[model samples]
Target chain A: MKEIYLDNNATTKVDEAVFEEMRPYFCELYGNPSSMHFFGGQVQGKVTEARGRVATLLGASPEEIVFTACGTESDNAAIRSALEVFPERRHVITSRVEHPAVLTQCRNLTQRGYRVTEIGVDGTGRLDMEELQAAVDDDTAIVSLMWANNETGVIFPVEEAAALAKSKGALFHSDAVQAVGKLPINMADSRIDMLSLSGHKLHAPKGIGVLYLRKGTPFRPFLVGGHQERSRRAGTENAAAIIALGKACELAGQHMDAENTTVKALRDRLQDALMRIIPHARINGGGAERLPNTTSIAFEFVEGEAILMLLSELGICASSGSACTSGSLEPSHVLRAMGVPFTCAHGSIRFSLSRYTTEAEIETVIREMPPIITRLRQMSPFGREFLKEQS
Target chain B: MWDYTPIVKDHFLNPRNVGDIPDADAVGEVGSLACGDALKLYLKLDESKDKIVDAKFQTFGCASAIASSSALTEMVKGKNLDEALAISNQDIADFLGGLPEEKMHCSVMGQEALEVAIAKYRGHEAPVHSHDHDHGPAYPDQEGTVVCKCFGITDVFLKKVIETNRLTTPEQVTHFTKAGGGCGGCIPKIKELIDEVMGARPEEPRKRPEKLSNMKKMQLIQEVLERDVRPLLWADGGDLELIDIDGSKVQVAFRKACAGCASSGNTARMVEIKLRDLVAEDIVVEEVPA
Candidate 1:
């Protein structure tokens, strides 16, 4: 069977165009961009040009974009940098439902005597704006929030959050790892003072990410090492990955319209069909505005691991809340935060589409999923009880 | 993804005889929805000697939890009470090679059901209800709050399972209670209670003196059989007659309730085997029907 991959939210396959663009840098153009020799200077020009392309994608000046290892590093740099800028501001504001990269960093900061006010989210996984606004005070140094949730695909109101932080005279940062390419975000117009984006989320290879620090933004150096990324982010540049990231951005810009419309339709169809076929199944964050490409569903009485395994057998690639956590034992914290019942939480599956996803692939999943669910439920002692209880 | 052992996968994918059997001889229930999982075991007994004739189960939880219950039913069926009681959680995991350590409680839950079922058949209440041991703080009064919802473990259930399993610490309670292991919200309280129960040694330890004379061993064994072991056997429609004791070996013959039981092997394991485990490992015992 042709593998039907639907877990784009987890990661995407590298685009061919982006790969071809990066191939030469791996072998032929191996000279360090920092060297002053003619051979190295030529590669430096290519690196500078790639930087400009990435800057164009985010509507930022080339000087403002600093290449980093990945989105987590970018997020850590932005948050830690802001904390260093205003040491007196001991409190920071963030949401409870952020990705672990942000959450763990916040937790580590909390351990270091910094007060972290973790704002709650509504049932739909949307931030509680009132609580967020109230959380900011004189002691609050900055506000960090994710532009899009990885699990439920719920989009936060970054513009409004930015305005809130700006009004409070606190720096605002966003982990836009899931948002940058899928949605049009302009660093020039947006109120976000700093932003982080990962290449893998936008069809670029892993290990390459960009951190955007708007001009005159209060920040401190996170990585203390050799001067690279214009002394903003230190370390030798991932020359090949950066080139691939630049090309991926170019492709993202070209395919943005198709991704929003065609991919949206495919995702919607999958959601609708899954709901129609499976009883008691519903989209997570149904009331919230989510990314067009991601759909998370809770399959009652079915453990996510069991479902994912069954899907794997059929060569259908999809992710589940239970399959993505600690030892694959804990359900998605996002689902738990939304007050999802354990009966369904363990059974939640995320089917994230991509521009590469096809109608035929979606059709195969729609046709195949119900039987798989039924088959799994039959094996479930809990599922049998749930059906009996409902009946 | 971790590759599942075929048996673990089989139990997870097609758990045997799931769902409750109404009008069952005994029912053993553990865990709850708030605790992330729960199990309900229904059993049919032969009644005459209290041998389990059939077992069915229903569970709500993760893959391992469901798999454990499924395996439990398969292990317990066709075995007499003593034989079934001897089946430990390790045996369950070993049957499938092994499960991940995080999933060890799945096997623990299986063994718990067997223990609970055996308790029910003997008309003995689970130790969870006994108010004998008073650990430090008073147990929670609210039913819902008392139970650690992540693992479906209650303080009452924890106390009982701990006593029954001879668990000495909060970690051991986790093995039996399956609490403090899920969300870990209740770990501190669980650990505190376990320490309180196990901190000070019991005034009179359950373990007999290190080395007793052969005469003393025989006298004690006779006393244990008449007081503890015999009553339990008689309640289950079985009786035992002491044959001989030779150098830590006690030979016994079956009588009354277990005279010709098809599950006599189980009865022997229960009476003879349990005697060995409870008394001393060195005190080997053999069961031969009279």
Candidate 2:
């Protein structure tokens, strides 16, 4: 069975162009960027060019980008620095549906005498702006919100939310990991003070991430070692990944239209067909404006892992919002925050498409998915009860 | 994706006896959707009612859970009712090659269902066990302390698994029985259980001298940290350093992997308890974040 990879939101395959660009950096141009020699100087110029390309993608100056390990590190660096710089402040604000990188860290901060306010989301996964407005106050040190949710691909009002945070004299940060390549962002308009992005989510390799610290955002070093990243971040940069990220970003500029059109159509087609064929199937966050490539479906009375396993057998790879898939007892925080019922939450599957997802693959999934649900339902005890109720 | 054995995959993909039997002599149900897994089992007895001629199940759960339920029905087919009732969770795991430790609860669910099924066959109303604390070995419903609030695991179950399995680490205890897999307020208690069960050394119970100087107390605390705590932690790619001594309250920084380790709460308790046993009974240890 040929693999149909629709779990792109988890991690993308590195583009051939991006890989080729990074190839030279590994063996040929292995000079230390911090070194003074002509050999190192040449390599440093390439890195600087890479930085400019990333900056161009976000519509920001090169000086604003600070490279870090990954999206989590970027988020940590940004949030930790903000709290440290404003020692008098003791409160933080974020949405309940944020990725664990933001949510767990903020929750952990509560133990250190920091009060965190997690703004609620509606059934459609849209942030409640009134609640967010009420949550932000003078004592708030930083407000961290995700530009887009990875699970539902629901876009939050980052620009509006960031502005609200800044009104109360709080530093605003957005983890734009899922949004960077998918959405056209202009940091020059500048409501966002810090934005964290990862390489892997946008067809670049992992091990490299960027924290766009809009210049003069009271920075404190997270990984303090050598004077790398202008002493804002320390330790040596992942040179190959940084170079690959630049190429990926430059390509992302060209591919945004296809992502919003062709990839989005594939997602919509798959979602519409599955919902039509399978009874009691529903879409999560269907009411909101979602990313072009993501669709989350809940197959009622069926287990997500069982559905995923059946899908895996046919080489249709995707992720689950199910707790069993994560080895935890609770389903996804995003679904729970949106008040998705227990019947649906444990059985949710996320199909996040990419530019590479073909129309034929979507058709195959549409054809294959209905029978799998029917088969699982036939074996399920609750499915029988649910069917009787429906009848 | 949980690295389930090939047999588990097979049982899951082609689960046996999937539907309920119409003329089942006994029906047993366990778990709930809120708990993330549930099983409904039906046992049809032969003419004598001594042996199960056929068995079937209906499950609402993950792959491992469905597989475990399916596996149980297959294992009990054409078996004596007493023999079927005797099969344990470990037997189910062994029948399916093996299950992941994290998914061990699924097998436990199967055991609970089978036990209830047999009880029903014998006309005894089985005790109800839900996903919450009511189902644990030692909870409010039972005799011992409910150690892990997250998974509703009890100290009695913790101690039993430790002695039965000859377990050493707190991580192992969570694996065999989900005792400390929760908010971890009970981790210190788990560490103490492991210490009491595994470290069965005759304690001298160091008697305190009257009117010891502050300097002497600090030295004793430092001596214990260097001698006892740091070495045990260093063996596990973890280390700690004593920061300050505020009378009986000792502040320390957990360094290396132990600094932000999930088990550090238990590890910290292990240190405090060990210090009290070695240094002073009233000595309290707190981690000052590094």
Candidate 3:
């Protein structure tokens, strides 16, 4: 069966162009960028060019970009550096809906005698800016928020939130892992002191990420070792993956309009069709501004793992916020923080699109999704009651 | 993705008896929308009102849940009420070629529904589905206080699962019954219940032998400490190492959270009790500096 890959928020297929760009670095151009020989000097030039490409896409200077292993590493480095740089500060601020990369770090800090406040989200998955405003005080060392939620695709007003943090002398960081390529971000005119982005989310290979540090920002190194990444991040560079990410970023810049237009249309058509054809279903973050490529739909009276299993049988890949799929026995933290009802929270399925998502795939999903919901509902006791009431 | 068995996938894809018998003689329902999974099982008894002539199920849950329900209906079709009640959650899992450990609760849900249906059929008051308020016991028919508020599970229900599954840890209890899977405020209580249930087991194989040499007694003491005592401490994020064994006195040092805990004295007393019960009646446990 032909696979209809839709789970882009989880990860994306490496773009062919990005793959080609990194192909030569594995064995042929296998020189460390820091080596003193001529062979290493040539590889260093390519590395510099790649850095410039990545910088261009983010509207950041090449000097501000420090390559890390992946988005988690970038997130860790950004948050840890801020807390270390401001030792007198004893508080951290984040949101309940942040990815585990940021949320876990902030939570672990509490064990070390640091106060951590997690701002809640409203019903539409929108950040409670008022709660953030109230939480940010002079003792707060950093405020870490995600630019866009991975599950609901709800966008956060990080620029305004950063201003709030700045007013309190707290460094603001954004984990833009899900937002960087899908949404245009210009760090040059932003108040965000640190920004983290991953490679695989935007069609680059995995194992490469960037931490954008604003120039003149007071900082401390998270990893102290050899002078790779200007000693900001230690360990030998993942040379090939870095090259891949740079090419992917340049391509993302060129395809930004298409992502917003063509891809957005595909997502809307899928969402509208499913809502129309299926009964007792609702979009999770329908009231909020969301990324163009993502839609989370909650099918009532059914669980998400059952829906996903049926979809997997038909080779239609997607993800779920249901407790069963997550192995947590509770629904997604993102949906839970949004105050979604348990009836819907246990049944939410997320479908994330990418530039490679075709119109036919969306049509296939629209056609196949209603029956899957219908079949599961037919087998559900609650669904039977709802059907009886309808009759 | 869950490593669902082939039998599970087959059952989920084409579930057996996937609807209600409107004239069902005995209907049993367990779980709620809030719990993320639920099953409504129906049984049509024969004219004798003893044997289950037909069984069907309607489920709102994951693949394993649906599969477990389907497997239960298939397993109980021609069995009498007593025989059907004899079916354990493990039997239901075994019928489906075994479910994942985390998905064990699905099989337990199937078994609970069966018990509720049979109890209701016998004209006994089974408050399995009476979840009208949050503060009341989740299953009023069952005894004991509520433990997991998120799932509205009671201590009696948790103990039953823990005992039947031979579960030793709080995490295993969560997998089987979702007792401490929520806010986990009741985790300490769950651990106490586990100890209570495990301690009450009949004819435990870990009992101390009646006659033993000093060498055998020392080995048995170490075995009991490693096998029984340390695991219980580890559950509470504490640990202990046997530092020295001098005659009847067993010297130990606490590590992690147990080292300087205000309750270390109490913990040491508990260890002494366990050692006496399992190793030797006169054995003593002493706390020593690390």
Question: Which stretch of 10 consecutive residues in model 1 chain B shows the poorest summed lDDT?
Answer: B133-142
Q: lDDT (CA) for every model shown?
A: 0.78, 0.85, 0.90
TM-score of each: 0.82, 0.82, 0.86
Off by over 4 Å in 1: A323-325, A328-330, A379-382, A385-391, B19-23, B47-49, B127-178, B182-185, B189-290
| Winning model by DockQ | 3
In candidate 3, which residue ranges exceed 4 Å CA deviation?
B127-141, B200-290
Report the C-alpha lDDT of model 3 over A1-391, residue by residue, as the tens digit. Answer: 9899999999999999999999999889999989999988888888898899999999999999999989999999999999889999999999999999999999999999999999999999999989999889999999999999999999999999999999999999999999988999999999999999999999999889999999999878888888898888888888888889999999999999999999999999999999999999999989999999999999999999999999999999999999999888888989989989889999999999999999999998998998899889889998988988998
Compared with the true structure, what per-residue lDDT tens digits does model 1 show for residues A135-195? 8887889899999999899999999999999897899999999987888878889899999
- Which of the two, 1 or 3, has more lDDT? 3
Candidates ranked, most accurate by DockQ first: 3, 2, 1
Better of 2 and 3 by lDDT: 3
Best by TM-score: 3
| C-alpha lDDT of residue A247 in model 3 | 95
Q: How do the residues A269-291 of candidate 2 rate in per-residue lDDT, one tens digit apiece?
A: 89988888889988999999999
Model 1 TM-score, 2 decimals: 0.82
- Model 2 TM-score, all chains together: 0.82
Clashes of each: 5, 0, 0
Docking class of 2: acceptable
